[model samples]
Target: MGYHVVAMPYPGRGHINPLLNLSYLLVSKDDITVTFVLTEEWLALIGPVSGAPNIRLLSIPNVVPSERTRSADFIGFLNAVFTKMEAPFDRLLDQLGLPVSCIVADTFLPWMTTVGSRRNIPVVSLWTMAPSMFSVHYYFDLLAAHGHSPDDNLPERREEIIDYLPGVSSMRVADLPYPTVGRGGSTRKHVIEAFSVITKAQAILFTSFYELQPHVLNTLRANLPVPIYAAGPSIPFLSLKVPPSKPIASGAAAYFDWLDSQPEASVLYVSLGSFLSTSMEQMQELSMGLKASSVRYLWITRSEASSLQEACGEMGLIVPWCDQLKVLCHSSVAGFLTHCGWNSTMESIYAGVPMLTFPLFVDQYHNSKLIVEDWGIGLKLKQRVGEEYVIGREEIAETVKRLMDLNGNEGRELRKRAKELQETCQRAIKLGGSTDNNLNAFVRDVVQGQCNFAN
Candidate 1:
């Protein structure tokens, strides 16, 4: 039977994007079809899809709460997702004309595993975060057994090493994804449930390359009952192979022109994040700091760009949005001041741009540690004083100056390491590279989904 895979990602940018990228890869192969499922509301939010004729986007009703207001009452939203979504989703599956050969689902939405089990469909659990984070969550019991608890992360014991985890390096307690890091309100229960149900899946897909976390991947493969596939960085490598007629940096020709006028490796590319940002006070302080440092910069943000530009002076250009990967790859772009989101981290690595990590929440702290400590491709920007976590303008200025320093030994070494890592990423995406081989292996032998005659 021909391969007809159905993908249902949790309606979040981070989760949806990697699943879509993986779908693109699958549909690129012959005799394969993909039906991507989303809430009707989310489909409208994401706009249109182009290029792949074999891929189809199918939607269920907006049964869950609005994405915009989700943060307000996250627990209510979680409950809705857990209880309200599955009936409509399963009904939508029944309406599909084609038999679902395989179901690719986000690991966060554990209910999909239930759907798979009830229907006897082969499900592939797609984990959007790092394998290291997955390892921590998958083995939550081990953490408790080793005298660790989520609420027990004391500041005095912050630097204590977590040496017990298999295939994981001993790191400080502060680096574990905890202590103001969780999404709160049923999130832990859902993730733990997600891990528990993975054994029921036919396969598990990690949105990371083997080179990035070989030991972690190996550990997961050995521990899990199902087969595991490393789907790689999940960036837009396909675009590079077959260039678009217009640049992916479309509608930002003005910014590219601005970058072109700058000196080589002199401009700092800044993007905090789309969701969850710093406080207004900190934002104002950062603007003044960038201005004081007098470093050439291009900042991408969705909030109060004009005011930020006024505060930042003529040294920086503020845009509402742009193709981030294209901006990072530009020659004039020196470094990235980032929120350390996993997607942004992977892009920074792929572009070989050393990072100034300012982690805010969730897995970002863990990612920051990997960048600063494990990878040696980034520096930590710390400026908290006393009880006020808000970083001051003077401190921000000093850190920005240090990161963008052309002549400093620390900057030079970071640049060299970043370049080396960039080269490594480039090879990993090549035809015979680890990622390419792994992807080929996946598409060549993917499991089929439900194919009932009634459907």
Candidate 2:
């Protein structure tokens, strides 16, 4: 039998999608068997949505059901899995028909480290975000020692400046992810625990290109104990499979058609990713902004934000969920307005679209910094209160006009740079690219028992 590589993805669209893609990559190889273990909720989403063959799907009982899950519940649910599900997972592992050789797990799930330990299977932790963000989490220990913990009651203003990051320039505390800035000791404790488990991992895999974060990757490798693997532009890897059923409908089909109607590099695609919440007031401002810009747009509206469709109708098209990659690849999409999620960032980079970043929670702030400051492919907005917060009509109109204007030579340059990054990311995932090389070497050397883990 081929080597058995079991994967356990964190629950939610963000984590599950990338893990599924990676599993697909592993399964494509001649001598590999991928058994993807997911929660019941995730299985519902993946089984219905993806068409990954030669891969096995195994569902574990989610201690919490889908209806009870909120954005905040994710961490708690993972903690529960760590504490309560070990025996069940062990039972599953012991009963496997094939001999398990290695464990490829989410860095977010620290509990799996123990599973690998007990089985003598090398566990490689995958950080599915920018390496810059990993650097922040990996070094959060020093921050805690220097009084950056939630228990310290760090002043709101003091949290504004993240002056210590190596290549991240001009970052403020308010821009940091919620877990990093909050007084909730629970989140802080969880982050430390997660990274602690990560340190014991046999290797670290990042869903980022080495060229994108060269300096930060260097610093992280120096500090981290394991070999760091940059395996990314995962969307291209995932999109290789055509889903059994179309993930979007004919109504969504019109959105892409409209994209084709726009001039090359003229439309703005706005999506807040899969897991963000927007208040009515914020939604209204966004509507007015798009209306005033007179720029064509393709916007993704969630079930809750569906009400704002009427307000944004004339100049923009709103769809429930889109084939984001397909839309971004359209010649019409010039720039993206996003919540700065890592998956979204990577997708935008792969599509060569510049960004207008308004980050929400988790590594988003860090992703935004690298996009805006380091790569010069995007811009960040100052957070404002009251009516001005959600891209007021004037600001929206002005920003879009500027990004599209001939006088906006800088933006044109940025667009060129984004294209360059896109090419580099494409090469990084190709057969001879960095990520492909690492993945192949990993299977041969580590997963196939050619090398042993650290003592």
Candidate 3:
């Protein structure tokens, strides 16, 4: 009997992809078996699980509403996961013929701690965000005690500089995770409660690398009782030979062909992720801005912005979707205009593309800070006026022009830094690299029942 690991991700594309990548990496090792658990709906949508011999897919009932219907009601989905899914999950576990050795679960689904504890199985919590963002969640109690807990009405609190966290020189309160401020107090409390469960796990895995945030990682290790593993930028380790089970959006070949026709480092790629939606007003502003900038660009959006196609004239290609990774890797992609989702952040970093960040929500603000302030690899889109956040077409156009300016010193510098970080990300995932070594060690520790607090 080999190690039988049940990998459970929070039923979202961003969360599922990394866990699936980890499963693929694990099953590639000898004498390892991984069962990736997903909702039946997602499994069907994802098409198939293509991986090593030891990898398998399992689905539970999707009690929550479909993403299209629940796009605005994320809290309802979280409530469903918390209240409805456990019984089905347990029953499925009981029916499995193989004795499960351990469980790897998304950090957001903290109830996995209780499930693993009851079964006497070691649970590894996988945080699918940046370490800096995790640090804010991990230290939420301390922040609350210090009167820094976000209030719905207190917009001024965001500008206050946070000097307490280790290795972080000068991050503002604005740079902390989004739930801390934007969501109501109850949502904030819920997030804190969820993350609190991480302490109960035997180990915690981060989809980040030591090189990216060494100070934050070290701080977490010092503060947390369980072992912490930086096993990430997981996309690189993922086998590209096996194509994505489904195309993420549409016009896959046409987008690539369009890229082929453009000059090297000339096109800006814009995507705002799967879950977030933009207001029609914002969409119009973005469309007008792209037109005003006169930069050749590819914009992937889920909304009906067909009017923008004629508005953009010959300068832009507006598609519903494209293979994001493929588009990013294209020679013509000079910059990314993104919402700064962690997956997008990692992908952009890996692809060596500079960005014009227009972060919309949760953790994205922090990610933008890292890109613009910490990493110096991207420029921030100016959207704030006084305490209110607003982006006009002219502002967007100016930022776009600045990012795409090949002859400008700032644009050249951003690209140089982005490319350098891209190489670092590649090196971290390659054979014998930091992420590879950490992942291997984590797997070995789990199999041998030796995972414990690493001081």
Candidate 4:
């Protein structure tokens, strides 16, 4: 039998999608077999997702919360992830037919490190976010010692420049992950706990390519005890090269037909992820702003799409959902208005689309800072009012115009720089590229049952 690599993705779309993509890459080699383990409920949730013939799908009981109700009590759900699921996952690992090579697990499940210890299997922690964000979590103790950690009663500060974190660029305190801006301490504690135990893993992996953040990767290599690799751009990018005969999402044909009529680089693609959403007032303002901007747009938001369509009719198309990466790659799509989730950010970079960032939760604010300050390929959109942050329709309209103006120098610079980053990312996935090399090295190390190589 080939080397048996088992994967345990955190049960969320954002985490599961990239883990599966990496699994697919591993299974491409005929000498490798990947058994992807998930909760029985999750297998049913994401029905019939594609996989290679050597990749196996197995499930444990639904030990955690359901996907539909996770958001209602996310803290409780997080508690369950950290506490309840490990036993079932441990039992399932033994029932597999072959001897396991190593476990490639989501970084959020620190308990997996312990499970690997007891079972004598090396575990590679896969962090499915930007390496820059990883540094934020890795060095969170420094943030807490310096009074930057979130406290429910603490006053929010925006101007404090944190230049001390190794490899991370200097940015205002507000641009740190949303949790640091005095949100809640429950999730913040869980976040810190997740990264704390990663030293026990055989190595760590980022869903980012090296060229995207070289300094951060270098500094992490120096400070971290375990080996680290950038085996990524880990979206379903390989599939993008194959042209589709029909649209992937429902009613996708109509919108794609609309795209065929629009001029190149004319439409803005918008999606504020499904996990979190804007308030009704904010959504209404956004819809009206799109109408006022007079720029063509294709918006993919789930909530209140009918109402938003009414507000944003003549100049825009609002759909419940579509193939996001496919839509970003469309000829007419010039820019993205996004929640700055890392998956969406990587997809936009791969598609060469500039961004107008409106971050909602953890890591997203940091991702926005990378796009706007470090990368220079996007503009940020958040207006502060006393203790609250709100974006008025006029502000949204003006920023949209600024980003969509093909004739303007600033807009042209954004597009030019976006294409440059896009090329860098594309090259990283090619043969002998950074991502490919790292992935190959990772496989070699796993087969040897060690993590002592440099990237």
Best by lDDT: 4
lDDT (10s digit) by residue, model 3, range 1-455: 57899988988888998888788878877788998888998889877775466878889987877866665566676777777777888888998899888899998787888888888888889999999888777777667776776543257777787777654557777676655232223466567778867788888999887788988888888877788999888664364555645433344447676777899999999998888777778888889999999999999886775887778889799888777877898789999999899988989999999988888777888899899989998988844412135578999999999999999999989989998999998898888999989988998897556655321
- What are the TM-scores, per candidate, against the unseen true structure? 0.93, 0.90, 0.93, 0.95
> How well is each residue in 207-315 modelled by candidate 2, as lDDT tens digits?
7777787887887777677778777756654563454243343666577667766888888888987775666767777778878877888889775545667777767
lDDT at position 336, candidate 2: 89
CA lDDT of each prediction against the hidden true structure: 0.80, 0.73, 0.81, 0.85
Candidate 1 segments exceeding 4 Å error: 179-186, 242-253, 383-388, 448-455
RMSD of each: 3.3, 3.2, 2.9, 2.6
TM-score, predicted candidate 3 vs. hidden true structure = 0.93
Which regions of candidate 4 are displaced past 4 Å? 152-156, 180-185, 248-253, 383-388, 448-455
Steric clash count of candidate 4: 0
Q: Which ten residues in a row have the lowest lDDT in candidate 3?
A: 178-187
> Model 3, stretches more than 4 Å misplaced?
180-185, 241-252, 385-388, 452-455
The total of clashing pairs for model 2 equals 4
